[model samples]
Target chain A: MSRAALLVLADGRFPAGGHAHSGGAEAAVKAGRVSGAGSLEEFCRGRLHTAGLVAASLAAGAVLGLDPVELDGAADARTPSPALRTAARRLGRQLMRAARATWPSAELDALAREFPKGAHQPVVLGLAARAAGLGAEDAAYCAVYESVSGPASATVRLLSLDPFDATGVLARLAPDLDRVAHQAVEAARCALVNGVDALPAASAPLLEISAEVHAAWPVRLFAS
Target chain B: MHLDHNHTHDGPPAVSADAHRPDGRRRALRIGLGGPVGSGKTATVAALCKALRDELSLAVVTNDIYTREDAEFLLREAVLPPERITAVETGACPHTAIRDDISANLEAVEDLEDEIGPLDLILVESGGDNLTATFSKGLVDAQIFVIDVAGGDDIPRKGGPGVTTADLLVVNKTDLAPHVGSDLGRMAADAKAQRAELPVVFQSLRAEGGVKDVAEWVRGQLAAWVA
Candidate 1:
């Protein structure tokens, strides 16, 4: 596997539409849940263990050659909020377009045709990783890292939190990110044996609720 | 190299800048309008739509910094049918949405085509931002940077990417030039110095010939595109 491809996929500037969504951070910031770096760290930690773990597992499974369509459905079943589901699919579709252009494959094209709208972002992420010749662990790491990094950078923009402090938040979460990626790969292996239900169904009810609220905002910065 | 292995499938192409769709029909000419906050980007888009809607099948995609205000404005004005306009939330970084990560805008434009197809033009309007902001070539075929005399006549003299590289630079609200203490002659001279041979239009939407020169430039671009 080309290890360099992982960097390409993980880049914040990959142009897959992640810049427009805050991963519920907008709602969290408005609710005063993530005011400064300390609270931002707490919010990211909670997110890392729950939503991060689930997304990582989904991405890892996709890298393991699991059926992406079924994986997409599994993603839908795990996400409770209707608004979040819509965001996931939209982001997934955007990611699919970027991935196909970056690392075109018959598998990706087939998946794109199947879900023209989208198929959950983690599923597309894993397929993109696979197409780039990356492994399940790499895909998991990318997914896990993204779950926190998105919120951290967005919080910097949302609250004008010090960029250094936000980077420190991400740095402090490195061990947690490693653990989540490891756990995700393990769950993905279990799914490879026993189907996608073996993957983690970790949910953040607050994130779901806040996402719904954020979606309804007549005036807001991020899309979700 | 990316397209090598995927030759057989008949699916939507991954890249969005292609001149032709999968069915072999020419796609719409996408023009971007970008400028500083309150420089009249939205007004230009609305005026362009109103001027060209009769002759062209046109649509618009708006990148609003915080709210759907620009899209709401176009809708409120009834310049185009509601279905022909779409808004993209920029997450407080309008420049990023148009230049760095244009996926959302691309999706918006493609969705417009998929839904209301065979369009002749699509105007992608960026949220009011700094002078550094310009549309990516991947996003728009041509770009217009709008700066009004009210903002400052020295903007062209400032010579950022928007002023120097845009296909067309528009000095808007010319009627307010005297009121705002801006020198239109010096502004034009500085713009010519900065842009060399590129086109610049001094327009006043409140004036008798509103958006005429811009509409004509767009028509010329469309003619070249369809040629």
Candidate 2:
């Protein structure tokens, strides 16, 4: 697999409609759970371990040739908030459009036909990676990185925190990202041997609860 | 290696720029309106809807920076049925939603077509932003950049992308020019200099038939699109 494919897939500016979402960071910021770099790091770390792990495992499973339809069901089962589910499907649909234009895989086209509304976003991301000649590990890395990167950048906007400090927070969390990606890949391998049930189902209850509240806000910066 | 394969598919087109829908009928003519804050964009949209609704089937998609204020205003005014208007959250960057990353706007327009479709026109109004904001060509066939005399008479001279590159440059709030001490003649001349052959419309929606000229421009665009 080309190493550069991972960079293209992971770039925040890939134009897959991820910019409109804060990945639950907007809620954390508003709830006073995240303030500066220190608190932001804590929030990202928690997200990386729970929602990040689950999303990464799902993505890795998809790249491992696991059925995306079932993986999408697994994703829905892991994500407790109805609002987050809607956001995931919306992001999935948008990502499908971008992926079909960029990579143009028959598999991606089939998935698009299957889920006209959307599949889960991580599932689409993994299929996009496969279409781009990337591996399961690359897909997992993409998911885990996005999990932390989203909230870090969002905090820069939400708190007016120094951009450099946000970068520092991400840089400091590199080891954790690597560990989570490794764990996710191992889980995906296990799932291939057993079934989709072997994937992690880590849950972040506050993130789920806050996402529900954020979706109803009449006025807010981020979508979720 | 797989990238060399043909993209022929059996489902709806992935790209939003396709003029035809899944069933092979031409889609609506999409027009985007972008301008600075308080530049009468929503008012112009309301007026245009009021002017054209009886004759054409139209829907609106608003990219509001934070609130659904623009959509609510259109609904409150009863410009069209509540179902005819949709608002897209811009995450504080209106330009990104319309220009750099248009996935959200594309989905909104496609949804409009799927639900209230075979429509003649779809008006996409950008959130009030700076002079640099403009709609992506993929998102809209034609774009109108709005500026008010109250903003500055010299905006045309300043000449950003929106002022210089839009299909139509509208100088709104012409009635306020006198009170605001803005020179319409100079604004017009500067606009002529910046836009060579592109069209410009100056109007105050408070006046009788204020949106008529702009509405006619839209009608011409629709005629060309359908042709």
Candidate 3:
């Protein structure tokens, strides 16, 4: 497996429709919880442990050659907010297009045929990693990093937070990101044996609740 | 790297820049309108909608910088039914959405066609940004770059991708040119010099039949697309 494949998949500019989404940072920012870099760190930390963990585990499972349709169902069941579900599917469709174009494979084609509208994004991301010849840990790292990167970048746009500050926040979270990625790969290994039930079910009530509120906003920068 | 487009569903997978839809029919001609802030891209879209609604089936996809303002404006004007207008949130990177990562805009246009849709044309309106903003060929068959006299007459002289390479360069608000002390002749001349033989239309929506030139140009584009 090529290490460069991980870099390509995890790059912030992968053009996978992640730019339009803020991963709940918009909602949290508007709710006055993620105003400053300090608070931004806290927000990323909470999201990293919950939503990020779940997404990473899913990606890892998919990379391990688990059934994508089952993983998609697991993704849907894990997602509580209708808005987030829609976003996940939309992102999935977008990632699917980019992935299919970049790395043409039978698995991607079959997935595209099955879920033309979309499956869950993390599933597609993991499969994209698999097609790119990346390992399960690579897929987990991509998912977990994306979980935080989306919000950190969005915060710079939303609160006019300094880019340096945002970068620093990410820097502080690096060790934790590594740990979460490892844990996610471990969970994927467990799920490979015990079924999808072995995957993590960490959930952030605030992120889910805020996503619903953000979706109803008549005016907002990020989609959600 | 497969330049050979396979429209057949049984063939190898293809995505991005495909001209055919999933149903084996051709997709509607997509024209992108991009310009700077307050350059009348939205207003031009509304006028185009009003002008061509009788003869053609049209839909609109608007990229709003921070809100659904452009899409709502089209709906408020009753230019098209609510179902035909889709707004894509740009996450403050309007240029990125249209030119770099066109997935969302493509999705919006595809969904519009799927919902209300054997349409003749789809106008993709980019959020007002800088002169550098332009649409990717993957997103639109043709593109119209709009600029107003108020922004500066030198916009033509200082041409960007939007001004120099657009299929059509529209010097909008020509009616305001005199009021703003702009040289219409110079703007036209600069545009001609920048793009030899490429079309440029000067329009002012306030004038009766002002969008006629643009409408006619759009008609020509649609005709050529079908041909």
lDDT digits (tens) for residues A94-196 of candidate 2: 9989988889899998898899888999999999999999999999999999999999988888899999999999999999999999999999999999999
lDDT of 1 by residue, A1-224 (tens): 98789999999999999988898899999998989999999999999999999999999999998999999999999999999999999999989988988998989988988998888999999999999999999999999999999999999999988999999999999999999999999999999999998889988899999998889999998998
For each candidate, report its DockQ versus the true two-chain complex. 0.74, 0.66, 0.63
What fraction of the true interface does each of the listed models get right, in terms of native contacts kept?
A: 0.79, 0.60, 0.68
* Candidate 1 residue spans exceeding 4 A from truth: B1-10
Scored against the true structure, residue A154 in model 1 reaches a CA lDDT of: 94
lDDT of 1 at A102: 91
Candidate 1: tens digits of C-alpha lDDT, residues B1-227: 12234343365654768776655667789999999999999999988988899899999999989998999999999999999999999888999999998888988988898899789999999999999999999889999999999998889999999999999999999999989899999999999999999999999999765899999999999999888
Q: Which window of ten consecutive residues has the lowest lDDT sum in model 2 chain A?
A: A109-118
Predicted candidate 3 versus true structure: per-residue lDDT over B97-161, tens digit per residue: 99989999988888887788578899999999898998998899999999999999999999888
How many clashes in each structure? 0, 0, 0
Residue pairs that clash (backbone atoms under 3 angstroms), model 2: none
Candidate 1 lDDT at B138 equals 85
Model 2 ranges with Cα > 4 A deviation: B1-10
